[model samples]
Target chain A: MNSTDSLIDQLAQDGAAPRPASLPRFVAPLALAMAICAIGIALVLEAPFIGMAINGPGPMLVKWGFSIALLLLSGFALWFIGRPGKATGATMATLAVPFILLAALLGADLAIGQRAFPGETWQRCLAAMAVMSPIAFGGAILAARWLAPTNLHRAGLVAGMFGGAAAMTAYSPHCPEHGMAYVAVFYCLPILTMAALGWLLGPRLLRW
Target chain B: MGKQTDFSGDTLDQLMASARAGDSAAYRRFLSEAAQRIRAMLARKIGADSELEDVVQECLIAIHAKRHTLDPGRPVAPWMYAIANYKLIDHWRRRGRSPIEFDDAADMAVAADTLASTDIETLLEKLPRAQADAIRMTHIEGLSNREAGERIGVGVSAMKLRVHRGMAQLKKIAEKDRI
Candidate 1:
């Protein structure tokens, strides 16, 4: 046999299995969960004062619960996408639906309450969104590279991160009650942290 | 003998698995076996005018660096070809050629035209090691004079002179051969 054929034979015998099928089922859920939790964590950290106003026992608890759920979802999705076969488009769309719904709900609420959103509040939200945008996209792309067999997953992650982050910011300027602190705490930190975590864990978790 | 042939396939598979696990010896063996094919491909693509050995080595290093991206279950031929193609394109770009339009056939023809006859190879063998390397890198490897100089730890002007002198000597030998 030719040397090239021999090299190919060697590659085939090295236990590189075709990517698993359950990838999208895992990835979509994980991405959604991560987004939700990151936003929740930022809200709690920035709005500790809200706890006293509400006469709550602990305001941070709500934020922590959301954050944990987000993280769990992201992790689970990542694990799922790291499996063997190609993930279906329907599976990805299923994951994206909730994000669109949530964005719409929040956007509508903010639009109706625009009178409350001041210039300073809008600025902070815009800044936070800007920072989060690249991080979210970078994280998604890195995750896709790590987990999915095809480069398409990486592209999706990058697109989703930027798209979702941009959408959140675009809607944020309309909400008067949603201060700059809220945007900084909710949107920015989560994406940055997720990006960092994804970078650290990618090689280990997403190995073929 | 039939059993032995089946065992050879199993042995190859085991070697690949071991290489994936970072076994250096398996990787070396794989390279040794693949070198001829790589050389053949390079020779066909760039022709005997250039230093086929340098291209072969560069291709090996690239395959090593990008090996992680290769799907172990898939055929390695395409991946190898892709890397080799990329390296050749890079070679062209470094030499200020617009690599986009340059095809394998054109590259081979250019390489063939630039190569000295076999007699020159004998004369090259007689030069100082560094001088010979500079000549080969500039003429045979198709590296720019600056690149050849950098590679041989000499200045560009010095490298140019070396190549000039080498070519002159080669011409003298060719004349002697004619006589």
Candidate 2:
């Protein structure tokens, strides 16, 4: 046998061992902690979807959906944490999906409401965008850290695109009456800008 | 109990069991015993890089934090080696560089032998058989936690935890020796 093997044999004969616990125990607690924190943040921010409900869907359905989504997101986060190197990119991509949808939906709602641009509604839209921008960036950072993708730039780009798409959906309803032109200028531009920012910042912040 | 032919064996297994049960003292002893071997293995793999000790320490902490996955009946060397190897890979990947492959088995053999003498074996003499065996299979043999678990008939998570705690104890011992 080689020296390493011989040494192993020697150590085997000497015998100083240890016993440690598994990953699930730690992961479960961590998942719980993250869920609690996320819920607390939602409460603090008074996130509209958390407590309020759309009339047709009923409050129960809305609450259940929200709870389910939170649970799923928490589970995803735990998975990402456990395998930081491989899950970061996937988590970022997954997170951007909801954001893009929300943004578009919000925009569409504004459009239907005939909320005037460069007015109170526009101000709210801008404020919402500003708030969301940091959130998207922060989420991307977290995803990159967890996934540990080889090409972070590409991961960021994907995250950005997903974010833009989700945001467009949320903002679609609120689009101004100027038709497609308004949608193109208002919705498309901001989404693109956010996407670009995600792509740019993700790599620098997510490096191992 | 009966003239105790396997004194080290029984003691090591007990310590491992205690660590799994969350005994901090056993955990420390486990780390103390494994540190030198880890250092030696790392030295062979990466030469005398300035970050060797840090890498070893990080690997040990990871092992400690993940030890409940180990099996009581198996060896520990392969698991430790795998962790060290992965850490080195992470270091290179973070630097945007691919791992440098060893050119030949002879070179690897030489390095492995050199690594075996990094003062770990001497420390192992203070340990028990089961602990030593677990350490050897996981750290020295480079087996996966799952594979090691299978050999010892324990769950993968248990094997991982055992490896983790064992490495932590070894590290503590090495630090004490250095001091």
TM per candidate comes to 0.38, 0.36
Model 1, runs deviating above 4 Å: A1-45, A48-122, A132-208, B1-15, B21-25, B49-51, B97-179
Query: In candidate 2 chain B, what residue range of length 10 has the lowest lDDT sum?
Result: B102-111
lDDT tens string, model 1, B1-179? 24322323433344544566667567556665556667777655544423456667666665654454455544456556666665655554454443323232433343245433455467678765555676678667879878876664555645655565555555555556657
**The 10-residue segment with the lowest total lDDT in model 2 chain A:** A172-181
Per-residue lDDT tens digits for candidate 2, residues B1-179, read 34322234544445555554556566556565566777777666554444566776666655554443343443455445555565666665554443433222332243254435456667655554445555677667977767877786655544544455455556556566667
Chain B alone, TM-score of each model? 0.48, 0.43
Off by over 4 Å in 2: A1-75, A82-123, A135-208, B1-17, B29-41, B48-50, B61-179
Q: How does candidate 2 score on lDDT?
A: 0.49
